[model samples]
Target: MKISARNTLKGTVKEIKEGVVNNEITIQLAGGQEIISIITQTSSNALGLKLGKAVTAVIKASNVMVAVED
Candidate 1:
């Protein structure tokens, strides 16, 4: 597989909030930061994203965009 992702942030799984079936999961990062991604409802178990579980948030610089309107 041609996978290209960079900029990884290591943080513990503060809290895993579940949504609807096969819905997105909220990933809590270090420094009290939160990120939401559309992942399987079972992702929590697959990645062991429970409390105190160390996980990495991979974010490519280019993949991230910033915007501002005045």
Candidate 2:
């Protein structure tokens, strides 16, 4: 999945933690650093986020957001 963010970290997905009813998936990096990313509200195809899968985690600042009008 190509996500547009500030930075990207190339790593393997080590594990997945899913709740009882479509909970968020917590992807663990190869280096043992776990990052919790929300599965998009519209994504329901089950992209099979599994272990040992090569993936990229987009890193961005939390304080970056603003509202605008057209």
lDDT of each: 0.69, 0.62
Q: Please, what is the TM-score per model?
A: 0.62, 0.51
Candidate 1 lDDT by residue in tens digits, 17-62: 6776665555677778877656677765677666776777778789
Top-lDDT candidate index: 1
- Residue 30 of model 1 has an lDDT of 73
Mind giving the per-residue lDDT tens digits that candidate 2 earns over 1-70? 6655677667766556565555454656667787666664334125656777677767775645778997
Error of 1 at 26 (Å): 4.3
RMSD in order of candidates: 3.1, 7.7
Lowest lDDT sum, 10 consecutive residues, model 1, at: 19-28
Candidate 1 residue runs with Cα over 4 Å from true position: 1-3, 23-28, 68-70
Query: Over 4 Å off in model 2, which ranges?
Result: 1-4, 20-34, 40-45, 62-70
Measured with C-alpha atoms, the lDDT of residue 34 in candidate 2 is 75
Best by TM-score: 1
